[model samples]
Target: MDKNLLGNNVIAQIGILVHDIEKTSQVYAEFFGMMKPEWSLTDAVDKAKTEYKSEPTEARAKLAFFDMGSLQLELIEPDEHPSTWREHLNEHGEGPHHIAFFIKGMEEKVKLLELNGMALTQKGEYTGGRYAYMDTFKELKVMVELLENDN
Candidate 1:
């Protein structure tokens, strides 16, 4: 039980799965008295290099972000592809998906989590960095997202 496996222990974001990004984003924005954030689609499969269960996948999702001070709230509407988001949405319906932590050393962090019995579920590259989704639901009751930025 090495708590140090996850350095800093700060949650950078919370991702929520949704059926409709447009409607959900508007509701959230109105509730907070802010403009609805623009939603964007994830990078194409070739660019993102997304994988699911260790197999290359063409899964992509629409994403919107709300900056909540130190933490970010992400809304995701996944296409009908075999992705973590889509799976969660189909199985559990629209709700919380993952809690993300901004981390360094992507490979090492992923290895550490895998060694600890948290299997890597999905991964992909974004514009400036990459992200990994770990199946930590059995232990943590929620999926864990590891984000490594190339800053």
Candidate 2:
């Protein structure tokens, strides 16, 4: 079997696009006994550090993360600005958006995916690392997120 692209078999997170992160998170917490997630706004994201469709773009969203054992559940509520989250929500409504893999060789994996015809849809940096979202939805039925954390 080909080695896993992420180098690990574990899925880091399952991301969902929601119209209202607070409401959706509440539902998840109530239904699954998951703890309340800590919310973070995308306002701190540097637009100069982000790209969409290979072009500079501005996008923002409210995000919440809940740790579930070795994995995490990520909820995203897109802001009024145009973003991958907004695009997914508009096209498919609020639902499953992507599954993330925490990897080390981010650029190499991204290039590999591109060579395989998966387009890079979005990319940005945060506190500890950077992330890239690949447009693999057509083939995989869900976007693939690659995260490289500086640890």
Candidate 3:
């Protein structure tokens, strides 16, 4: 069993995936008084088209991160057609996309998810950071991310 998944992990962040960033930024800034600082715009984005042929149109997402206290609030916007965010938006129109939790023993947790039943959707390295994806779709409908420690 994956004892590494102990719940000391805080709700480190919440991500919102959208279609327009500049507009949404204003909305959030006004509502939450969220400060948009320099060096907050993330240039690291990797995209791949979904394999669902039955799904309508082709879409992709661009990611940007914002700091809220010690945690980050990542905003993602689709670049074209109708991607995951678009599908979510079309079905429900822009809301909380995912909840990121910080945890210890990332690699062990990922391995345990694999052992239990979760499927790994993607894995990659970006901007000198290491990350992995585990699908929790059928039940949770969220991707569980295993992020390498910054230290």
Candidate 4:
């Protein structure tokens, strides 16, 4: 396809699905000998404007982050509501979820991926940015997340 659809190939983060954030975060922290970061709930539907498979959804998730130099490790605990995270957890049972890249022009990036056969799965807003998950598992073996910070 087009060269550098993502503009840059640097991976900003790696996300993991977990059934229990508290227990999982503790395990990661102890294993890595790092302080466990506090986990927080994602924004509500209204604020997050979450959508699943192109439909609006109330799905939310608890998230914990650990900074690992150039890459951040994220752990996600999805609610019962349907979402990319929840689906992956239910189907795959808690493991790697997505590999994320920080990008500008989210709309264009999403469109490029969509044009290339990677359909958008889920998207939502956060405190300072927004995120979109792309259905890239079949080809890439993992979902792809686009992170756009409003800076």
Q: Highest lDDT, which number?
A: 4
In candidate 1, position 69 carries an lDDT of 96
Candidate 4, residues 1-151, lDDT tens digits: the string is: 6788899999999999999999999999999999999999999999999999989999988999999999999999999999999889999999999999999999999999999999999998999999999999998999999999999
Candidate 2, residue 6: lDDT: 58
Local distance difference test, each candidate: 0.94, 0.85, 0.59, 0.96
Candidate 1 residue 93 Cα shift, in angstroms, is 0.9
After best superposition, candidate 3 residue 117: deviation in angstroms? 1.7
State how far residue 65 of model 4 sits from its true place (Å). 0.4
By lDDT, is 1 or 2 better?
A: 1
TM per model? 0.98, 0.91, 0.65, 0.98
Q: Total clashing residue pairs per candidate?
A: 0, 0, 1, 0
| CA RMSD (A), model 3 | 5.1
Per-residue alpha-carbon lDDT of candidate 1 for residues 65-139, written as tens digits (9 for 90 to 100): 999999999999999989999999999998899999999999999999999999999999999999999999999
lDDT of 4 at 13: 97
Q: In model 2, which runs have C-alpha deviations exceeding 4 angstroms?
A: 1-3, 43-48
Instruction: Give one digit per residue, the lDDT tens place, for model 3 in 27-129.
Output: 7767777664322332323332233223323444566667778778777775555444555557656766666665556667666777878765544444545
| CA-RMSD of model 4 | 0.7
Clashes by residue pair, model 1: none
Candidate 2, run of 10 with poorest lDDT: 1-10
Task: Tell me the lDDT of candidate 3.
Answer: 0.59
